[model samples]
Target: MNPAGSLVESLLPLPVLLPLLGAGAALVLAGRPRVQRWVSVGVLVAVVAISAVLVAGAADRPHVLTVGSWPAPIGITLVADQLSTIMLLTSMTVTLLVLLYAIGQGTSDDETRTPVSIFHPTYLVLAAGVANAFLSGDLFNLYVGFEVLLMASYVLLTLGGTRSRVRAGLTYVVVNVVSSLIFLIGIALVYAAVGTLNLAQISERMAAVDPGTQLAIHLVLLTAFGIKAAVFPLSAWLPDSYPTAAAPVTAVFAGLLTKVGVYSIIRTQTLLFPDDPVAEDILMIAALATMVIGALGAIAQDDVKRVLSFTLVSHIGYMIFGVALATPAGVGAAIFYVVHHITVQATLFCVAGLVERVGGSTSTTRLAGLAAASPLLAVLYFVPAINLGGIPPLSGFIGKLGLVEAGVQDGSVLAWFLVGGAVLTSLLTLYAMAKVWVLAFWRPRDQLPVEHPEDAEFNDLDHEDDPDRRFPVMIGAGRAGSGEESYSGAFLGAARTASDDERVPVALPRGMTVATGTLVAVGLALTLVAGPLYSLTDRAAADLTARTPYVTAVFGQTVDERVTR
Candidate 1:
């Protein structure tokens, strides 16, 4: 390889390495948040730069690193193909901006549920785990990556340790632990059957394995990933759990974690078990159910976070729809949708966070007149909201178009059904968003549903009310903008410092707005660059379908050579 190739490959591992280093340093500097912020944010920014480099370099060739001087199927290998590199770039961008938003939250609120230092370390660990999952070249390492991120997420989810958080966190913990156990069991089964844990090796050896063994192992792995991805029946945990955490924390989960699961599914299905009819049929059915059920669920939601959470589940079906098609166009559409959803979804949750701050609540029923109070907040919500709802000219529309077109090209009856389901789901999603917009942003605050003493908070759903805390303050409240005069007042029981005019000026920490806005811009950037981006994903899906670039990069041997050997 040339020097340029070596440099690109060398950077393949840095996204995972640097974040672990920053996490440790953050732990060391736990007492000084300022230093920790610099360390964590600086590390993530560097990762973003490196991930972008990997994307640029991987347009033609994948970059691979062999750990401990060991060869493929022996040592831990890190890989960055067009697919993984793009995922790294997208995830890192979101993680960096979200970290900045989190920093703003820490600086503004001064609420000490969990200190900034601790949040920084845990958050960095989470980022590292996300990178590891994307870059891993083997199954064992992939499982390890999930565990690492799950551990970090457990802490992040229950950060405040509030009753709602703790209760929901417990459910989340049990579900993931069970999924992880199933995953481990599946790994053991895979190794026993295939004689190797490396993904590249498994891909080479899978065809020779018994059909029954393949089916069993495949089902087990899909079940595990499905639980993590929150696909329909496996999805009951997300809507309840995510709404309880702080805004930034929930946004991270909403944006990154399930997508990690989706990424795993993409890798496993395409590389190891491409074009399996049983798998495709199951995935197609699952996709249809997930789209309809998740959308209906979202329409029933009254809380901001829960609505977004259900929407998150609904969109996972879109990604699965791409996978079910099992064509290059299908996979490319899935990848594009994944990127679009991550940025757009995180922006909505951040806006939801801002809503919690500006309106003093996340409930559409309890909040009102946000269009009058903070037009900026409304606009912030509007762009991503429409994007998520598949309004035209946005990346979301492009992605959905790609998926529907792929389904049409597939020409299978099941595929056609899913294509229609997807369109219906899109319409339902828009309706849900419009419902929130009408109630939360358009209605006058005085006309909000009057809260009786017996009326439970939106998050309560059915959980018994804890006497100790009925409605604790949302975190991260500082004076709104740096230049704006801070008026001491309240908006619908929300802690507010704003001018007393009919339209209260909503002031958010500038960093938070800037971070969220940057992501919104990135989401838009995808639209502007859609042609190039789709071309890149087109090549990536071709590579995954070919299955040679990834295998040769990992094993240092051609597929023919491996087969002959």
Candidate 2:
């Protein structure tokens, strides 16, 4: 068998299917946490391996897996083009790292009520949803994928159900449910108008329709995805919801979910409604508003996670700018940007969690003197932070360069203005990151004046379990202590010590430097592989913009003339 063909067969579906099966197996034998953790790790590793093979072999051919041996348009399908493969591989790697990190930083004693048991199942389900969204051949299937992931997220976001978390979850749930409803309505309209749910069929039909009807459909779908993507007017739900989740959960959501929305927008723009008269104008205005508003929110934030959340919302504008350009280079840059942002943003959020763990809090007002506490942690924090702010020599620099260059060559005055705004946004992002660094890592203790414990007369509460009072991080139970709240517990008759401490903080382990190092290495991999990655992005962009391969592969035949405007 040809390696490329075999590679395609194994690469596309196996990553998702293997995990789905593993989640079921884990649930069936849920009595054992150790077994569940190991099974989840093994499943994720398998996914990573398969993803790597796909990325390596993607140069040979793009793979399309028809799930049930039925033809694509009628049956669900998964397609692994260069861009989708890249995202799939990265998402797997980041999620696995977060899971491993979480394993070490065990849950607090309140695990049962927090939906921690559902973590493995829901995480895999979200992964399946992501793969399905990337691979989906039709509009309705994309909606289904979105629903799978969103519902899973609703559980994950409110995992612990702390007071703040419940509030955040309510907002997240309501906003997303509304978006889902809009998405369904838009899909129904598209299906009724075009008489087909396949993406290519819709595109072909859209071309035959009048500009008014076509734009109406396009804008309707965009509105739904815009909310999902957290774009300007539709983006208010993001900052409040995202910052409240646990570290690993927040990391995965930041890394992958919003990008899925951006991906859908790109696919719809480049494939279904190419070069619409209104796309550039509308997106340009929206991109400007998103960039400015998101940046301002990031700057105003005192909490580390909240700042990062706002930054994530703002950065989606760059993707929108690329898609609006309607050129292969622009879309290619968007693909590159999406991958770059995923790694950098996810890593930064994880590092922020470590900061909150090590320092007493993530609030800039409270955190200080980390340089004295741990320089290694500072390095872990600074590298990705600067990279995310789009500093040169990192992958972010390369990605932003691609987007700006594409804008310059695009020949639209508006494009030039957007390019300028991107530069300004980058600088503003740097300012925001620098504010965090100064407050959290670099400021001198004497300058800020440490709090006087003597004056406060703080007491470590001692109960019967006082001899055993311990906060655990990454399995630091026996004598090792952490300031952060934990989820340690006992079985039916076992002695259990449980209490809530709003004042104490979670501390990162000495070895967590390893987790941070792993993430930094992943970022470096993007820079190291820049040439090959860019080439792959170019090919993917060409394939997407051409739209022929996807159409023929999914629909079995090209759409008829009546379906195309």
Candidate 3:
């Protein structure tokens, strides 16, 4: 191997290995919260640097590592091509930021709520699993990657053992376990049909397989990935499962986990069955459903977290749409969309966490006048919210434009229909975000409606004597009066009596705010570099569609030539 090839190959495993090692070290340092934090942060920072190096090295050709000196088709292999490396770099960057945010919030170190010892290790393990999933070169190894991440996520999700969290975690586990079973079945079927579990080898062998059997295998695998990606009918669990977790946990899960499934779909569809018309059609239909339905669901939501969760589901359809087009332009756009969505979604959730802290709740009815209360927080929320709604001059708009252009170029009936659906979904997303903006940020505290009058009465009684109480106190006092007239009057009276300044800002944790602001800034920065990024993804799509580059790099020769030799 050339010197450059050797160096790139050496780095392939570190994105996975470093995190696992860090997790173990974090476990040993369980009693030392400060040391654990340093170890975790240092490890992710290293992974990010390594992933950046790999992205540069793998731009022209893939770097493949055969585990334990064994050759391809026999031993475990890890491949870092343009697609995987891009994903690794982007995911690690976001993971690092989210970790910082978590540290700032002390979510992982609070013993009374989450066990300080378990949180760091479990989080590192989750990072390893995401890296492993992106790099695995075999179906079984990919399955291992999924299991590793899922297991770690199970721990992370139930960290507090709150009844709501535990219940949500249970639902997450059952859904993922079933998905894993289906994935295993699909892997078994692939190996049974081809006598090898190596992905490159499977791709090579699948060409001669019976068409009916190919269709069956394809459907089974897509079903499993669909569930994982939270595509439409398969996505009900996501909105329910994600919102109940802690903010940092929800942020990371919202950003990375579903993208892994989408990445798998992109990999398999292009490599294994690039010409499968039926599957492509099915994917197109699924993409449209996921988009429209998720947007509508987002519109119905009143909680900030739940609204973000539904939007997460909705935007996933954009990525799927790119993949379903089955063109280099389409797939390239999908890849870009994934990158854009990961950063934006995570940023919004982090902002939601901040909102919860400032407002005392995420409910629209309870949150009001946040624009005046914390202009900084309002800017943080609004920037990403509009970006997510596909506002122009942002990464979100760039990505959606790419997909819409690709759909137009395809010029098929279904493609046109999806184009219309994509536009509609974008508008609906804007509407949902605008609604949140008006109710949660714009409306005055005194003008806010009370959802549960009884709860408001209880709150009023609970904090009657507390002089320094914040917005909730105002709400409760407002609701204690006779009716709307009395309620509004009392609310305004309390606000005036409490302070002459109505805009006295609630103090937010500086560390958490800085971390979230940094992430939001990163999301905005994507627009500046969208051109080079999209170009990279386009080349990646070309290679994926060609398939030869990946397979040849895997075995150090074309699969056919290697077989003949």
Predicted model with the maximum lDDT: 3
TM-score of each model, paired residue for residue: 0.93, 0.88, 0.92
> Which rank order by lDDT, best down to worst?
3, 1, 2
Per-residue lDDT tens digits for candidate 1, residues 1-565, read: 5888899987888898899999999889876656767898799989999998999999888888988879888999899899999999998899888888877663333435566656777888999999999999989999999999999999988876677788999999999999999999999999999899999989988999998889999999999999999997899999989888888888888889999999999999999998589989999999999999999999998888899999999999999999988999999999999999999999999998888766656877667888877787888999899999999999999999999999999999999999999999999999999999998888876664444444434334312344423233333323232344232334443322223324354576576788888888888899999999999998999999889999988877887886799
Q: Alpha carbon lDDT of residue 279, candidate 3?
A: 94
Error at 448, model 2, angstroms: 3.4
Q: Tell me which of candidates 1 and 2 scores higher on TM-score.
A: 1
2 or 3, greater by TM-score? 3
Q: How many pairs in model 2 have backbone atoms within 3 A of each other, for residues 3 or more apart or on separate chains, i.e. clashes?
A: 18
lDDT of each: 0.85, 0.75, 0.86
* Comparing 1 and 3 on TM-score, the stronger one: 1
Task: Give a tens-digit lDDT track for model 2, residues 352-402.
Answer: 767756653466765666765677778888888888888888888888899
Off by over 4 Å in 2: 1-3, 108-116, 449-507, 555-565
Query: What TM-score does structure 1 among the candidates reach?
Result: 0.93
- Tell me the tens digit of each residue's lDDT in model 3 across 1-565: 5898899998888999999999999889978878888899999999999999999999889989999979988999999999999999999999999888887764344365466567888989999999999999999999999999999999988776656677889999999999999999999999888899998989999999999999999999999999999997899999999887778888999999999999999999999988899999999999999999999999999888899999999999999999999999999999999999999999999998787656556777667888876889889999999999999999999999999999999999999999999999999999999999998899877775433332342122112343233222110001122332122212221122222224344466666788899998999889999999999999999999999999999987996687799
Q: How accurate is candidate 3 locally (lDDT)?
A: 0.86
